[model samples]
Target: MVDPSPESVELARFSLWRSKLDCAFGWFEDAERTIESLLSPQAQNQPETLPFMIFIEPHLPRMEGLELLHLLRSHPSTQALPVVMFATSYDETDAARSRAAGASDYIVKPVDAREFMQVVSDTVARWLPVGSKKAD
Candidate 1:
């Protein structure tokens, strides 16, 4: 769930809708916005009540985004969260850099529905905690 601009939000939203896997996705234009919402009590309740996988797009400008990712991966609470990056091309050096930072996976954008669903299914299968399950 990596999206920084409104256009990115739209793209991710569309990709998510087209996915055949049962999952949950949320977006924020910036890191601070995502943090604020995620820190709230409502967000805390989500893990227990809804029991869905989370995909976050901190979407900070390159440097800032990297900083945010570092912070998240270093922080005790979110360090092991199942995060991934998405972009126009998987060839970008920066995407690899992001993986080095902490992303569990990365996806190339303009994803066809089939490939997109495959990625979603694969991520869920790999990341969802043992004994916990998603309805889809």
Candidate 2:
């Protein structure tokens, strides 16, 4: 997860935990740090350590999510990873741009807490490997 909002990150973390998904999660408040972490020599040396999926918000303080998505798509290590771009509200142009930039999905964040959590859980579940078991 690469959301700048602490609330958003906490919500996502709680949602994943409550869903009982056995997965590791990392959060980045800015795109530059995320880029550095992902494109570092250590990361390049061990591509397998890269994340299976990434959830990013469209608007960020430094580099925008779309720009970050483009960079990720161009990189060999993260090109194939599923990228989900989310926003507080739906915008046709943003959705189209995200798809063109190789985002796996685009979602409008729900204002309702429960609905938001459900969306997060469903999205994560959809991307999980087949036959994946819930955390005990």
Candidate 3:
């Protein structure tokens, strides 16, 4: 769920970074508009789905979207979903506050390819079901 810029190149790069997974993309012009869409009825009911790890770009235009993390955490339907936020920069205090607000984790942007891969892999690994094994 780590949405960078809407650039296709960025999306492709991210896709390539985790090519082995059954990855799908969800888009919303704003986070608030997308929460329900991303967590559609079908998606929520999937039995084999992995723990959701969202990478949100909080720097964009919609401030309400930023409130999405709190809203998701507050709602029972999405309360346990693991979310990871990505941003180019944030004041340390601001980042700390975001954590307090309920983001599972945060990643600073301009991430190198290697680090990006590792982070995504590690996050997915940590969040995956306990008896599950990594996809080959």
Clashes of each: 1, 0, 2
Please tell me which model should have the higher TM-score, number 1 or number 3. Answer: 3
Q: What is the C-alpha RMSD of each candidate to the true structure, in Å?
A: 4.2, 1.1, 3.7
Best by TM-score: 2
Local accuracy of candidate 2 as per-residue lDDT tens digits, 1-136: 9988888888889999999987888999989989999988888998877888999899988789999999999999999899999798899999999999999999988988888988989999998877674747
Candidate 1 residue-wise lDDT, 16-135, digit = tens? 556434456666666776555654567655654332344444345643556667766775556767676655555567677788998777666445755655565566667766765545
Q: lDDT per residue, candidate 3, 1-136, as tens digits?
A: 5353566325434744565555454555566455556456764576245345566666646553357777678766677777766666755865776788888777665456566556556666666556555367
Residue 80 C-alpha lDDT in model 2? 89
Runs with alpha carbons beyond 4 Å of true place in candidate 2? none
Global lDDT of each candidate: 0.59, 0.90, 0.61
- Lowest-scoring 10 consecutive residues by lDDT in candidate 2? 127-136
Model 2: residue 28 alpha-carbon error in angstroms: 0.1
Residue-level error in angstroms, candidate 3, position 36: 3.7
